[model samples]
Target: MTTAPLISLTWTDHVTGRQGHLVIDRLVRGVSSGGLRMREGCTLDEVTGLARGMTMKEALHYDPRKRYIPLGGAKGGIDCDPRDPQAYGVLVRYLRAMRPYIERFWTTGEDLGLTQDIVDRAVAEAGLVSSVQAVYPLLDDEAAARRRLADAFAVEVDGIGLDELAGGCGVAESVLTALDRAGVSREGTRVAVQGFGTMGGATARFLARAGLKVVAVADVKGTIANPEGLDVEALLAARDAYGTVHRTALRAHDAELPAGAWLSADAEVLVPAAVSYAVDTANQARVTARWIVEAANMPVLPDAEDLLSARGITVLPDVVVNSATNAWWWWTLFGDIGADADEAFAHIRRSMRALVEQVLTRAERDGTSPRVAAHAVVADRLPVIAERLGWYA
Candidate 1:
């Protein structure tokens, strides 16, 4: 309920001079959960907003009957390109600098340019027990929880890690739920996604599998588009760790356009699955899609959302769509779910669909945007959570 973060710390990297930031927006039961992202222009303000988003995400999935209790929200970000030679060292150093918080208050994994493997490596290098060790005290069986999460992370479907696919499954499910509500058909429905990293790639894969046409996918190099629907599998296979797609993997019919062409792609759904503040007011006018489902945090700027809403373009907020990955982690760790891929996907689909339907239905009733409706839901739940759990169980 506070406007400011509980704790905000900015550190200047000793070797590269890059700045890194940590924002603990709220803590419930003495712990907060979020992820650390590494990007070229990652700022303290961005991390602050993401931390608050995490708070909302944690609250949005709160279910008292479930074994997984939502932790508070916090986030970490470093202002450096993950591809830089010094990036890994910077990550290790940043982890080392924030070891105290990681050990005591924040439970973090991968976000944006970072991956879970990289985070684990950095955490070990920093001499920490685990990236999520902060919440161990709250677990009923710390060892079992640890093994459960580790096993879940190790399980892969169709050669992609389950951890990587969980968030995208949630995003795709949100889009499908919205379409189903509108009486739209999924078969041949067009989709354009920005960024082809773990989130975007997995989203494209699931949507394509569900009979949607992924016509465009944008990455650092540019956009790959095919009106007849792209080969999502091939492209996904060609991506690097940073999500850049290889040019050679493109088919003869696949057209390479400027990176920003994704906004103009002829599609019904546009998913900004990469960076924060991607769709701004200036470029929001280029969007022709009926829906913009955010798979990345804060992709649609507030001003852009207002304009898009006025134009009758629905924008699904990221807090609800992308909360699955974090929730999946806790659900597995806390025994609500197990280490099986089918069970994880099934749970993600059920929960995300229910959440999307709830938010959209509330928005229709309240005459508000989905973001506002989601915030209202969080507002109602936060107090209940605190009242019942006493803020620090």
Candidate 2:
């Protein structure tokens, strides 16, 4: 990967407190895009690394069958009290402050510590052009899923909106694809998801509904389990605002398991979508899941991934599992918008499943992990891709 260029911003406010070390990495065609994150423990390097990863995400997500609409990578972070009452106000100020840069050069959506409502309000407060109104700089005439979303962004400012639902669906598709490639049958595949938030919760529900037996789930507070299969929709409904299932709620259905119990659940698929670095070298051995889908970025680090690979665990990279959500190729192929909720999800499901199948097949043929194989394909084309778009000389 080429070295990334960086942009830095800083500010202090009496009402919202202090936030600094704002950064943007990897602008292409004088434009960049990624999610905005606000968290107390976030760091400058973390944000930079994430920004660079977005570039890799766009590049590695390439599919020969799909149009390669030019989109660059970038990420922003605000180190702040996510739970603070004033956080919302702070976010408004931050968005207002970022309007100048974003209006012409960047586009960001919700990520960690953010919500669709928050982004809408912030964009409204900033008096910037609505994302819907701004045409995607990429040149493509085909109707892709993202183009559908771009169109949706125009009309549905008040409706369900994008950010959308594909993250979970893509994850479920990746898990199922992995299971099939590994010769594991879906009917009896036990699954454990460490994170009951939107992504993880939706994934658990999707997988369970798809015939996989979901046996364990966790939130920050703790893990809950019932090998017989926890009631999916009930637990999802019982989750607190922060995705935590109260012990009282869990006791009624699943036995509240010990800390980190989700990692050891006798399952075939494990999705760590809650937080970064959830599975590292320290506990890679305790991980009993044969297949892992990284719904969250960098959930499994390099060293730990190596360990898992040696252990015969097939850990699909986030670039493959989480890649399709924002993949320009997908949006470009989506051809037209105005899709209802079911149509939207259905589109994503087909596209995601196809991508997963391709990646897994390539990994098998190349005799390498999906991460290595995917990156190998992307790295060769990076310079050519950049040069074609007049990004880097």
Segments in model 1 whose C-alpha atoms lie over 4 Å from true places: none
> Against the hidden true structure, what lDDT does model 1 obtain?
0.95
Per-model C-alpha lDDT, please? 0.95, 0.71
**How many clashes in candidate 1?**
0
Error of 1 at 210 (Å): 0.3
